[model samples]
Target: MIRALAVVLFALLLAGCSPQVETDQARLCRMALPALMADGAAIDILAETPDPDGRGLAVAFSARPSGPVPERHLAACRFREPGRPRESRDLIGLTLDGEALGEARLFALVRYWLATPEGRAADPAPLGDLTRAPVLSRRAAYALQMALDGLPLAAIYALLAAAYSLIYGLIGRINFAFGELAAAGGYGAAMTALALAGLPPAPLLAAAFVMAAAVALGWGFATARCVFIPLRRARGQQTLVATVGLAIFLQELLRVAQGDRASWMTPVLNQPFALARSGDFVAAATPMTFVASGVALGVALALVVVFRWTRAGREWRAYADDPLGAELLGVSPSATTARAFALSGALAGLAGAIMTASYGAVGYALSATLTLKALAAAVVGGIGSLPGAFLGGLVIGAAEAGWSAVFPIDDRDLAVYALLIVFIALRPSGLLGSRDPVVEGLRQSRS
Candidate 1:
């Protein structure tokens, strides 16, 4: 495994060093530079990079003869189609002297540069308004857009939380490696899709899901058998600490195998469905989002039913409620624990596959954040309650989406944890949770 990972990493490093291909933006900038300069002046455009503000390009160039260079020079060129009745209005421009330029400056420069009689005659309306084109009020559309975006994220969180809750409730040990299991599933699906690129989408998708679930299941079983089972006689905290190390090991392994760059999944069910439209403002949901959320909800419901009605689920509940008693009643502890781990991993893998498909990419960095969020959801939803986990995920997702509109992107996680803290302080049982035994015991001890 180490040798295979090393080889993959080496190949990725080689691919990154391969020759660069010129993009359309680069081509446009190159073509427009000559028009912006003096008629016969020799100028060479050397480098162009996106400005930090994302408004325009930062361009570097040197004028020939090496004479006194101006501290600042700005020019814009509006390229027009030669034979078209309707002229093309796209503008490209540069600001020299190590300063970033705005779109407004680019538009203004184009208008001023084209002020000559012939230039004006070629295209009238050179000083087109650069301000935002009029659109319906975004305020009215925010709620719907938030719902469309948040619900899918909520579904993903719920799936992950379910996985966490299942293993923790049954084993009384938190499996920190579950997130890596999900990442493994994502990589599995991505690899399978790449391997079977010639297959039709339906079959390919089905195969990818199977591959993802199988990979995660195997990992979960091995983790239980090799790690947790061996430490079964030890304290739960010891097993938890071991799982943390295991999580780190798995993450590093994936980083080596998959490389640092994100792996993009095939675009499946990604067509956008516009929910509401008023002028330029629109609320939309992609088919991918809907499909993923639907699958997550269906899976959650199915699991709920299985736990409530099935014999295997009864065995699981029996083990969770009282492992010693269950073992005495002829339930195989190792088999039950393995089954729990497998189911949890399968759910996590399914979630990962759907999430990667919806977002179109997966990376090693995603594992830690996803695990944290799912763990938070489980705790907030009353850790052992399946319905509560789903509800908690929705709450977290909605809170994040809504708060992002008001706060900086970097502060969004703070809002989630703050909410969790508030909930814990006020009601340790969570929204749907019964009184927590740990908290109750503490209170009784204090009394």
Candidate 2:
């Protein structure tokens, strides 16, 4: 793993050393100038200057006299929308090319220059249709938007991770099928909403949440009772493999029953509340984001209180520390395990319902991605640690949002997995994981 990471880092360094690529303005100049210049005229692009707002660029070019052209000619070409490379070609103009410049080309050039910051500053008439309100800058807007969008998602991840951690902490076994429980929750809510269409918003939403939790709870209980309990005496690997197969089975079952189409929920909190604004750019969040995040946080906090204060919580912890001892003491291992699964499923279901509402859609494929991300959170924060899971979810969400600001949209997932790899390499035990007593003993002995 270390060697693989080293290789990846070395490849990234090599990529950084690659040659610089041409700018959009330069490429556009090369394509447009030749067609407008006199036959055999030597055209050279001198320099390209971006407008103040960075939305457009002015290209200066020199054309040597050739054929009918008798003297050196210099002219400037401007692009109104520098980011839109395709549209830029139709907006170029030539000066020294003289009579060779066609009416169509001249018209395009005029529009391009008029759209530039300099041109707009000179005469705002060209952009009369555009918004003149104060708004955030483009880059700032994008970054803020991503951060806001990631908050609720992070909360959902926290809930999912917490569920996984709870189950693992109690049972010392990974429930690979937990992701399917989440998906089932989401699908349950969606179906309920459909069946209860035309109901008041409050009742509809309440029904969705209740139905989702109930469905997920039932699934978790059955899995524990029918599958996990029977395998309790079996090897750990056997249980792990069983859960994986179960996960795949559940995913396929959902796919066949729901069809491949994504089910979309009606917009719950669709009203946008702008947080920052400059010119045309705006950073905003919806009510749903805050509400969902708040609910997830509340659930996590409630669980913390329960575990710290309640009798059942004490029993659960006792079982986690030593199941055999707890069972010997009359703490019904089966009952505790069942309760843990049910509680975990309830949390997972709630998370799924919130996520589906936030995204407005749910599908079978989403389960795998969510599972992987939640697992990454659990591992990075400290496997089997609730606080660590929440912290890790936030870290992953922030990293993903921040990386998206600088990298291509398609590479976002790559950035996420890279973060996971780095965390694994640097802190295999996770951020909050307790040190292994065996490893500590080994170190002490060596000393």
Candidate 3:
């Protein structure tokens, strides 16, 4: 494992030598084809032409004919700037390359591409023949491809879920602020990457994670000292409310520090490497994915080992199982709770850094959504079950990825929520949970 990790780290170090800062051209290509005249979903005849200068993409689409006269449906996201590759970009220009094209010019350009003998498809068809392979190669490739793409997401979620489980078990209250801590961690990693741009790739990447975790640990310590410790004797609802407030406060702090919009960075070690090959398709992941996965899993494994075998782990488990019983048995509730906060916070922070490295974007707004998802993952896996948390994260991440490909993109979030509801209704104890946590807690209280 160490040898394989060394290889992945070495490769990443080499990748940092290149222009890790993704250019506008690379960003455009990252989202879609540089230049493509393909059929689209909403627009009948869709085409995209890239600006050679790396400015943006010009899109043109003609609506399918409703009658003898063709209707010109309004095309959304026809022109997209490199800055906002996902959103439609409309600009007034006539550059040599298609930096930005107005409606008329876009339509004209599409006509020129499709009408001209040089660019247009021959044989009396606007679209050239697209053949399907008999092996179901594309479908198989797609499923595997989604699984591969989801690996990093899974790693991040796994870490987050583990953190949630740790805190929930230790204190019997959820740390709603974990998602904010993750966002902060990502920001820390990004800032570190920018500052240490002169360093070698491997060191830079390592420093980023270290700094991110350190920062998060520091914050976690602060929250423990100021918020959690003071309320150690309080009820779960009070602690839960306190954490929610902390989450909100952290979000505002991060937003003020980083700003409203998501800060983008050049991808680190994002150059894709092939995982598997089908007839014409290849599933791939970057060196960073390997690095991220290794690091996240290592952290998780280490945590699990500590929880299972260490003296500290035993004490904490004792407290979580029965606070009064543990207090009577010589365990200090104060110390155990404090350590749990620090450890859980650090885990969440590392997950954020992984997100930044893998996705190349981070913002304060990510906190709420991430918290909800990770919480759902924790619940689905058995909220207080350490190992189950990691497993749940893997399941949730893969589910999101699979749903995106198999179903309409719009309904993806809904699916996760639905799954959460199903798990709660059918099996409140979760996969690894031996009994329903609520019922168990009540029984313990009575005893």
Candidate 4:
């Protein structure tokens, strides 16, 4: 396992060093930097946007050159197509301090802007690592930012909820211990990153995520094997009780390992690209959020594909629909349950790694909150419905974000729980739940 992780980390490192791919803002910033530096000017933007006609990108700039007189100017990076490669689009000129320079003049520089003394200066130490592009709008920009914040959260909750749904569908039982399992994954990620403190950020994070997934996968599979499998012949309440006990045990074990304190990893990708701007707020999103969301999306697609097409998935579905019939048809219950639990654990681990990478802190006590939220998400979406779980996560995450944006931040959790309560009270079957969840439960129980 260690060797495999080492290989993965090495690959990530090699990938990172392979090329310099610039995001739109990064590209504009990179182009603007040398020109701004040449004139000893700094940029403060109210808005930056691509041309509606696709000519190039333009940014409103307040240029503060190293002169007694500071001036404001309009700046743009002209390109045939904004999305094309560097060699494709020739920049016309970036005007700084009333001087216009062509791409050749700007591109040919004595020193790289990223390494230069003037370009390196930022308000804070960390902002130096980022490029800024702000779009002006009070409502639209703030909404965009909220979406960015909420999407990552949605991605995380969706992952957990999906795990819940997967296990529930397989065994007709919920693994309440998944939250603890996620925390274990976070611990694994943190410890791995801490151990590899000397590695570059990208490789370090890659290794951490891999470790997190491995740890969670092992624990999840073991939990199913040791705790849930034996209780297969027992009542639902008994399985629930067993898993809850397992949850508590895992939490306490982790807490003891942590010496009752959270372990923190050094921040990775803390610098955000300024996406838009409202009056006192800049809608900022880091690359990490997008990455997390993408992973969730990818996982969701993979799950969908597996469930719809694979023979194992068909067997699992048959077992879920009718256990005795599936068994008679030659499906091995043990093998099916093991694979299902392992996949669920891997999903949990991915969630943990994302949470850690985004927040940079992990604690054992977080297990309960995570588990409860994920459970609520699952219940709200449709306990055994994979698509519903993802949708429910989005609903909860969006609600939390919107509430925090407009209302008091401290009562955010209250709002989330209140929403869950309303869902439970009004639609116990959830948004996309079975037509008769009560009937399904009774049927499963009798069988």
Each candidate: RMSD: 15.1, 17.1, 10.2, 11.5
Q: How many pairs collide in each candidate, listed in order?
A: 0, 7, 1, 0
Minimum summed lDDT over a 10-residue window in model 4 is located at 122-131
lDDT of 2: 0.72
Q: Which digits, one per residue and each the tens of the lDDT, describe model 2 over residues 1-447?
A: 999999997875464333221243344444555445555666555555545433444555666655544444444445554233445444544444334357675765445643355433432111112233346677777778888988987987888888888887777778887788889899998888778644434566678888988998998898889877787777538888998998999899989999888998765544454676655666777767886787778888999998999988988888777676778998987888888888888888887888887877888888898888888888888877889889888888887778777778788788878888998899987898666774334323321
Model 4 residue 39 lDDT score: 54
Candidate 4 per-residue lDDT, tens place, 1-447, comes to 999999997986576544222243334444455345435466555445555444455555565668656566665655534333344224444555456665566655323442356544432212222344555778888889888989878988999999999988777788888888888888888889778654545677779888998999999889878987777788548888898899989988988877678877655555476776666567778777877888789889999999999998898788888777889989998889888898899889988888887887888888889998998899999888899999998888998899988999999988899989999899987898787655486447633
Candidate 4 lDDT score at position 444:
74
Off by over 4 Å in 3: 1-136, 436-439, 442-447
| Pick by lDDT: 1 or 4, better one | 4
Query: Candidates' lDDT values, in order?
Result: 0.69, 0.72, 0.71, 0.75
Query: For candidate 3, lDDT tens digit of each residue in 284-331?
Result: 666777788788789878987898899999998888777878899999
Highest lDDT, which number? 4
* lDDT score of residue 144 within candidate 1: 73
Q: After superposing candidate 4, which stretches have Cα over 4 Å from the reference?
A: 1-134, 198-202, 436-443
Using TM-score, give the best candidate's number. 4
Deviation (Å) of 282 in candidate 4? 1.7
Model 1 over residues 118-219: C-alpha lDDT tens digits? 444432111122122333457767677777888767877888888887876776667888788889899998888878644434566678888988999888
CA shift of 416, model 3, Å: 0.5
lDDT, residue 292, candidate 1:
75
Please give the ranking of all candidate structures by TM-score, highest first, separated by commas: 4, 3, 1, 2
